[model samples]
Target chain A: MTQQDRAHATREAILHAAAQEFDRLGYERTSLTAVLARAGLTKGAFYFHFPSKEAVADALVERQTELWAQVRESWRLRGVDPLSALHGMFAESADRMAADVVLRAGVRLNADREVGYPGVPSTHLMWEKLVATYVIEAAERGDLRPGVDPEAVARTLCSAALGSRLISSATTECADFPSRIREVLGHVLPCITAPAWELSGSQSASEPA
Target chain B: MTQQDRAHATREAILHAAAQEFDRLGYERTSLTAVLARAGLTKGAFYFHFPSKEAVADALVERQTELWAQVRESWRLRGVDPLSALHGMFAESADRMAADVVLRAGVRLNADREVGYPGVPSTHLMWEKLVATYVIEAAERGDLRPGVDPEAVARTLCSAALGSRLISSATTECADFPSRIREVLGHVLPCITAPAWELSGSQSASEPA
Candidate 1:
């Protein structure tokens, strides 16, 4: 392999080891020596890649941000429609939550002031804009109901996806996660779409109100 | 006050002191000496009430769980319909996210298996059951749509609420939190009711499936 490729692989390996260690041992108890020992790398190698624990953490956050960016980009390539893209995003989050609860927890913990990755303003604005753009496009294509607010729909969908990912971290069973995503999408998508009118009031008065 | 009431008050004072210490210094950094000092109680008195740090944590969890139970009882007394009562619960959680972020964080962190709280299962299961009962009641009351599974709806709703509380802990701002809870609830609540429907659709073209 090329020297650059080898270096990239080594860096990724270090990060993977670090994530596992941090998730298992937590931030305070874990040490660089332990990380190096687990990674099977020399102290010099560890230092060369990450100057400190915080630096490694910053790198982890950066990596996650990049990964999410790619996921968003894929949605853009697949379809310019908002509702479908939003559902796809929620589905993707559910799959990730099922596979790696640690990753979900890591994301929640790292986003705080303690980890200190403020992220870009553009990135901060991305979810809303992406959803809003798709919603606007869908409206133009006559897919949405008359007078539905794209911004509100986008915000609601984004919040539900994020909230679900956060919740899945605490749950022991991942069996129903995808179905939960579908359930949220099913309720939320109809509210924002033209087809909502087709649903008759077939539900009974169940909850005490 | 009666002797029993005085004793109960002192025990609560100690528990409150312990919660604050754990929240401020975290689990590892906190010490029994510091907790006793903060509570203005002697070591003997502290030991009389609790044997160890874990005991204190258990007490706190029990206290919070009781608070939740009281909230449930209060909701029932209000005589609202099931769906409205469910909304009231979400709204209370939102308010508490602002009112008691620290307690919420402690509960969320304690729930983490990595963090450890042996007592969480019984307490958490009780809370979940209570939520499920309310959801089922809502479904039966015609507040939720037909064909939506109450158990699934309850589980997802509880998860989302837990997620929202965790997210709230990471920030000082509540400006967006209330709306965020509402947004998620708006989507999920319909699935538990009859003839499920979401609120609105995006204005963009439908993306490729």
Candidate 2:
């Protein structure tokens, strides 16, 4: 393999290993040595990729942001309308968080008080901006109801999503998370969308949670 | 004052002093000695009320819950409809958290991982259950849209309320929290309520966020 490709592979291995450790043991308890062992890499190789466990956790957060950006791009490529793109994005994003260990670990670390770095823009705000971008696009497309404010809609949606996940983690079983998301979307959709607007394909945002 | 009245006053002073410290210095930085001084009470009196800083913080949480219950009871006495009571409860709760030092401290302490007691029920669940109770009342009053699930609406509202407050704290100015809450209520209201439903005299839920 090329030297550059080998370096990239090493970084990915460290991040994956770190994510698993962070998810299972939390940021406080996960150690560099355990991560290196999990990755089956030498200490030198691990050091070349990440300086510390904090750096490894930081990379996971950055990776989640990148994953979301890619999701937006894919929706654009699929020729979906802006409103439809949003419904699709929420569904896909929820599925990814549930199924992808690295992304889930990033989410957990984002909430970890010890691991959080103040002055950095919140990952929650980044997601809000992304959703706001789509809400603005939907407005430009004349898909929103009259007098609807895109920024307000975006803020509410972002908050609702976070609250749903937090509440679910606290009380409801994990399997019910998607249902909670659906309930939120179903109620919220009718408020902002023009009556004529519809979610793309067979999907319905108005479905009961 | 009666002996019971004097004892209750002492408890209130200790709680108030602890709330201000917890609000300003956070749960970790606040000290029992400081709280005693602020309350103008002896260690003996303080010990009669709370055993430790953790107990003081827990009392703050319990007080917030009690305050919300009183709000609900007040609404019932005013003969407000269930859905309208829900909106008023949100507005008043938001206002109280902003204006009342004790309530604000309770909120911050709830989010503090170092202070969290794992086995205790999340205060968020208590609010969710309270919201759900109103939703059921709304449905029985023939106020809900056909086929709308009261539980779903309740869950969405609770999550939305939480998400709005969290996001506002993370980025938006604190003053904007009410607007964020309004945006959420406006959107979610349309999906669950019968089209003829209204939010009581002079207060409209459909205001553009």
Most lDDT-accurate candidate: 2
Q: How accurate locally, in lDDT, is each candidate?
A: 0.60, 0.75
DockQ of each: 0.16, 0.44
Q: Which candidate's TM-score is highest? A: 2
Q: Pick the candidate with the highest DockQ.
A: 2
Residues B90-135, candidate 1, lDDT per residue (tens digit)? Answer: 6665666455534553464365433222223533344557778877
Please write out the lDDT profile of model 1 over residues A82-177, one tens digit for every residue. Answer: 556656665665666456534543554454323112122323235556778877887887777787677666666655554454344334434345
Residue A117 CA displacement from its true place in model 2, Å: 8.2
Q: Give per-residue CA lDDT, model 2, range A68-153, as digits (tens).
A: 77977877887878878787777666666656678867776775532123345777777778799999999998999999999888
Each model's chain A TM-score: 0.67, 0.74
Q: State how far residue A166 of model 1 sits from its true place (Å).
A: 3.7
Residue A208 in candidate 1, Cα distance off native in Å? 41
Give the i-RMS of model 1 in Å: 5.3
C-alpha DockQ for predicted model 1: 0.16
lDDT of 2: 0.75
CA lDDT, candidate 1, residue A26: 58
